[model samples]
Target chain A: MAGYQDLVLRVNLTTGKVATESLNKEWARDFLGGKGLGIKYLYEEVGPGVEALSPENKLIFMTGPFTGTIVPCSGKLGIITKSPLNGYILDCSIGGSAAVEIKRAGYDAVIVEGKSDYPVYLLIEDGQVELKEAGDYWGLCCHDTEEKLKKVYGDDYSVLSIGPAGENLVAYACITSDLYRQAGRGGVGAVMGSKMLKAVVVKGTGAVRAADAKKLMDVTYNAYKNDLLTDTNLWAYTDGTPMIVELSQTTGILPTRNFQQGTFDQFANIKSEAVAAAREAKKGCVSCGLGCGNFTRVGEAVVEGPEYETLSIAGSNCGINDLGAIVKFNANCDAFGLDTISAGGTIAFAMEMTEKGIYDFGIRFGDADKYVELPELIAKREGLGAELALGAKKLAEKYGGIEFAMQVKGLEFPGYDPRGAWGMGLAYATAPRGACHMSAWPVADEAYGEGNPFTIEGKAEMVKDLQHYNAAKFSLILCDFWALSFDIMAEMLSALLGEEVTAQSLEQAGERIFNLARLFNTREGLSAKDDVLPARIHRHPLATGSTEGKTLPEEEFIKMLLEYYSIRGWDNNGVPSGEKLQELGLR
Target chain B: MIIIELRGPLARYGCEHGEKGRIEAKADNGVTVRQILNQVPIPLQHVGLIVVNGKKGSLQTMLSEGDSVVIFPVVAGG
Candidate 1:
């Protein structure tokens, strides 16, 4: 495959050795790339229940065949590892130039294993690879660290670095790149921190060799570009995700007051219209056309988002609808290298705990004056920040109020409240990296799907198809916004690999990846019980908004899961049978 | 008079008519949202959700005087 460099860079930090190996063509064909190939590597080398931050585990940095090519929205870097926040096999896909830089640097994936005795950072320029001492750059925040690297390596280098949160081993820490873009979930940053690796800087002057450059460019410009320029995409381009503030608000799914309700009365104050006024600049990721990132000004600090998830969790859910405050809060998290979703969800949990008299951090819902001070403490594991740094699951475990912790499998949910869209409920439950919307965004179709968004019937099917499609696309690693249809993915993959791989085959590959992730978890003692939603979602019916008085019936939801499991060739316990594995060639 | 607030690109139609987003138009009490949308210059496909007074309503939903309609596009986010 011309698109794939067919090289895997193996770095042993402890041994201080680096080796370049030929790509496993068979695994590449079976697993595809990105998350798919990512899991294949992680699954093979790491033991079933290996400690997440252990040197025994490998951090696989992967890029797809479309990466570094003319493919729109293709600069996706997949960070695959056992999560320090949760025990699931996690693949956090981040957008930026790093993936493209990695691909152009002559490697499909870079598997970094073994812990370093001292802090170091890996630098890759074309084929030249070296592990340089990073002690001087260790404690800098994400933004400052990137600036320091850019000063030394020049602007051409694409740096993926961590910050104080990672250095301090914040459980929900994330890896930052391209300034604000991140592999933001599942504590992948902590994994990097544990390895004593500060950053992976790549400078690629070489062009990615695509299978058929003309065909790839033609299809990219003609089909994907034409469709993306339409009105729907125009909205994304203009407002980015700040528009979701209104959509979620007007539809009564804004995730307000610790998720006790779905509507936030103050939504207008923090919505797209408000954010647009504060927008100092629009940021685009690598090869991105839909560029939805907002670099908005708040006070003297100019920060990227406090996007939908941050706005919802830290804004509405925390009972603070001040957009500027949210922006500052967002900047603090990015500097501290915390996952904004997890950090915001954690604060919301603490507020609810204070309300319930379970614990007091002097926080309250509809009031977040204290949150601005929490991120730094959380990153440093200082004072109450230490307890709160454990995340919602562990906090709720120790202090009580587990019912409203707003987390699944130790991962916090995004802004979408599931009562309004039932498919999201299933998506949250079944996500391999815990309650992640990226696993598959059924909420998109469900919110826009025909008839009632409240319908239970066909939600399972919609979630299933999306999971498979996204799973496959994750390896091709196209952004969901880019993968509007499978035809585009199939055509591009075929053109890139110079093979006639259809969307059908690609989706099949996705199913294989999903199953493999499940297998990794099951091997680590995952059960059907793990495939369950938070009790708050099932029991607490929304008291206000579009989904007022709606909640998932627990037994019915289980039945739906059973149907989904059966559809996916799994048994009652949500385990994929041997025949299914054989079918995917995973056997 | 029925008040309809247009969002995203759907605002373009109202903008062309010298109305900024929120357009006031007369419609019979029982007219479907589809009918009102058809009367507007906007391409109906661009409108994903038709929220009537803060609730998700379908195109076939009946519209009435004093009822506010907010139309949004079917775009996605992370």
Candidate 2:
């Protein structure tokens, strides 16, 4: 309780009412904060059959106990809501100073509900909160809106805004903060657009108190020197995510040509070295020592990343090797507030559709010129962009190419090709928020480590454990870049809360949180039937590179899924059992 | 001579021997990957994946002269 502000801010745009309430201490104790806490709020406030874009769907912004503290890599803000794209429980963590600002504003969470008659932006300055008219800022891009808001509110405020993509209700529209960082999946921004809330700006000067400040500082400083700034975690600063491009290529998991192949011939042109060569500076989130962001400029394009996901899905998956073009595409997505992974996956699917004469959008693999122009069109919902805005699953549904949509549960696949790392297939399918890589990343152990990439022997346990680990970690709002173990997290939590916290307790909390999310999804009618990979993953084999002739056999995938459910104490239908629910106190 | 490539922070190991990221090491035919790694300053835990001739290689993987070995750090997240 010492690490918490113990306050919640609720704003109803339709009624023009803003009120503050005490934090749900029982829920906070059980779910902690960030993803877990945010999802718990959504499950309680929003009903099972709520439409994601309707006013009934609430948008919750949450911060964790570690936020605004000296805990390194704890600056990520969690946004939770029903996904407009997939109609599932969606939670996304974005890096920036927003979490710190929100916490300093003396609140653990901010809940925005209902729709405004006109465009408005919520401004919270210390204890003062008001809904201001955003008519002048409504049509601008994410960057311009942030810049204009900063001009009026001064630079000390943290701003989160949407762009044309969100305004047009693009299915994969994302929310942008700090100019570049985004809650970049599952149409959270579309939900914001639906409420006609263009931005949320916060300026807080309060401090987050710790229970044992001396012990917390000692742990923080020790971890900062011994655990955080070490060889195990320095890769974030040294090469960042671009290093994974080569690793994925070498291990035969790099998605290429819409996943028809596992390797790209032009991978060298877009690897970490290429990013470093174009790097102008390094950036990081608040309270971060290992700045993973590489600010790169190529010709007229300037952006923070074109990270591994963008580099793979937009670069090789599209058969376009031009790094400059990929950078331009990345800048376009940031400007338009579109999720790059979904945008790129949809385009690649379209390219294959065009090549196969299914439905030609006049775009093909390696068409860099046409590829760079699609994001804006999609954001504006004009011309071919209108069709592309539907995303891969919806496009495939409207059209006739469902098998190769490269999506699971309506969300597009990330960079790693699942055929090469079989556990990834399970992770993607079983992810609560559609096909999200952050839910669990077993490829790091299988394709990137000493584990066998082609086996399902320990994959079920591995995926389940990793999923629980990630769920708990994200709930604490820690940055994924830190590879600290559960013990470190428990130690920090114990110090901050003035209580005994153990790794075992944290792991149990993780299980409880994961089960609660499953309950949310199942309540909305998602079940084992929805936990499925694209047909191409089961049917198509890669034709080149180290993973040549490899496919995740359908039988092996099913065995893994069933085994995963068994290990998770779930029934054959992937529902948590009564005994398991009772054990987690969810009964 | 076997050409060894080190990536990310693991490049420090290669720098200890020959170049910054690349090292030309003398190894006999049929030498194991563990043996080659022992000759370097890198801790085995620091090595995430070992690749030999574009394929995944284990610690016991046999190494021959003129082979190419790439060592990566145990860093994963994006």
Give the best candidate by lDDT: 2
Model 1 deviation from the true structure expressed as Cα RMSD, one decimal place:
1.7
Give the per-residue lDDT digits (tens) of candidate 2, residues A379-492.
Answer: 999999999999999999998899999998889999999899999999999999888899899998989987888989999999999888988999988999998889999999
Score candidate 1 by TM-score against the native.
0.97
lDDT of 1: 0.84
What residue runs in model 2 are displaced by over 4 Å at the alpha carbon? B16-19
lDDT of 1 at A504: 80
Query: How large is the i-RMS for each model, in angstroms?
Result: 2.2, 1.2
Residues B1-78, candidate 1: write the lDDT tens digits: 888888876676664357777777676769888887777678766678777887778788888888888887777545
For every model shown, what is its TM-score relative to the native structure?
0.97, 0.98
lDDT of 1 by residue, A248-358 (tens): 876667888778999988888898889989998887787888777888998976777757888888899889978878888898998889998899898899898898887
Q: Chain B alone, TM-score of each model?
A: 0.82, 0.84
* Candidate 2 TM-score versus the reference: 0.98
